[model samples]
Target: MPHVPERRPESLGQAAYRQLQEAIETGALKPGDRVSVNALADQLAISRTPVREAIAWLETDGLIVHQPYLGRVIAELDHQMVNELYALRFVLEPAAVGMAAKNATDAEIDVLREMIAFERSVLDDPIERERHNRRFHNALYRTAHNRYVISTLSALQTPMILLGPATASDPKRLLDAYAEHTELVERIAAHDAEGARAVMMRHLTGGQRARVSYLLNQQRS
Candidate 1:
């Protein structure tokens, strides 16, 4: 019989959490998928104890919910949740973009530009493109110079990842996003705070529409 591979000693709880988190983020586990502690422990080559511990944490995070008899399942992504997410984004991100335009240092602006370039380079790889996109936005949030906003936005990362790969999966959409990002960056570089805010609002609105469309299509399929 095959034995569990021992790569190195690590915190089993943390390791299992990371494993499950990645699966959920990448849609490998997917929305509403039933989670089996025994099967997951086997898959991760770990014990059920750590898996249960991780599951308990995930429950607290609202990423997984316990049903009466079904145990824990990945939380469902619905239209209402999408609306609430975008509503929060609309309120937070435009302010972030405006602040970034007015307050970002030269080095911070340069980092943002480099991130856009990296995003463009990964057009063929949706996962990497999305990763760079998140990096760019995180940098923008930091450049906003609001520690509170940064912390709040950081907490949203997991759900943002759970939104799936639909938006970045299309080549044309990527090109369009690049253009929008270019405009946003140019405005920020010029310290046109209002212009940057406008562009960001448009970007967020477009993203929301795309997400709704993707979710509707998935429902039909």
Candidate 2:
């Protein structure tokens, strides 16, 4: 007989956090929308305690802000915020990729390739594709062998997730992104640190453009 692993049930706080996070990510909870803790708790069919806890956690991640009179609201993204975020990414991700070129083992590279394939297979499903996209970047972060870089990227995930409708949602953009990932992986496999960094810079710059365009379109709509 095969042994089965035990499954741990999610705590109310954890469940609330995930639901709230998804709402933010999909734009169901749009930026600048105020949060009503009791209202959300009632909507989730959970008590206020867990909902409050989730909000607190999100606040720490800079996903939600608490104003004196306005209460809690989703963090708004502007052109300046977008530029700052990408600038930070520019400083961090390229260096991480460069280090990954030197540090990632063949098995780690294989995992990244598998993630890319997974993303391609989910083209018809934006939600799954987005999940896989994050997974791929996270895999690369872990491959870098730097704890501070990994932690910083992890913390950034909250704000990053709030950017809805990925540029890869378009078929052409999806193909371009996949091609870029392929080239990046190739550069890493060859242990070309500088080449990997260059590819990463291009990738991030393109993504920043796409994100800005998406934000502008959202505003116009």
Candidate 3:
């Protein structure tokens, strides 16, 4: 699914990892898709060693798993994993937004506003919406100026790809989430730390509930 050109003689291992990881994150490689090390190496025009190295790292990161029959397939989000992800966000993101309220410059706040506008422009495109959703959150957290929180949230990106985004499912859900993002930007711009934190909590809680409902319906189907 990933189309990479010939190796550039740089860090081949890191390049392989990035290409493979990007494919997983972008849905070019979806959940439960069987991964072949040889296929990946050939596809990227790299050798087997780097691709295997990348696969090992992906397994360690929980983006890949070895099942009884499926071999190493892309991991899916189960109930427990969903709960754990939201629990971590509940602890980290709310506070991150609060810190962002206090620390973000007007320029950084403006960047967030621009991302929200861009998100609206691409609401009709699922792929672009998912991409901007990650961009928006990544920008928001960086405004907080806390390296530890940023690092923790960054580590969650791969598994979060499995869960996808709030906007991917329903048009109504996308509008609701857009409004929430607008309000969050306003709160941060006004330097309302507690208000921003409260808004983030609501956003995360809504996303958590939606994801759980989605998983249940998926099972029934």
Cα-based lDDT for every prediction: 0.84, 0.85, 0.86
Which tens-of-lDDT digit does each residue in 1-119 have in candidate 2?
Answer: 89999999999999999999989877789888999998999999999999999999989888899878898999887867888888999999999999999999999989888877777
Residue-by-residue lDDT tens digits, candidate 1, 1-221: 89989897778998999888878867798888898999999999999999999999888777888777888899877877888988888999999989999899999889888888887788888767777778777888999999988988766655777766655766666787888898898899999999999999988887787778778888899
Clashes of each: 0, 0, 0
Instruction: Order candidates by TM-score, high to low.
Output: 2, 1, 3
Runs with alpha carbons beyond 4 Å of true place in candidate 3: 1-10, 68-70, 164-167
Badly placed stretches (over 4 Å) of model 1 are 1-10
Model 2, TM vs. native: 0.91
Q: Between which residue pairs do clashes occur in model 2?
A: none
Residue 105 lDDT (model 2): 97
Ranking of candidates on lDDT, top first: 3, 2, 1
Q: Each candidate's root-mean-square deviation in Å?
A: 6.4, 2.6, 5.6
lDDT measured at residue 77 in model 2 versus the true structure, 0 to 100: 78
Scanning candidate 1 in windows of ten residues, the lowest lDDT window is: 164-173
Q: What is the TM-score of each candidate against the true structure?
A: 0.89, 0.91, 0.87
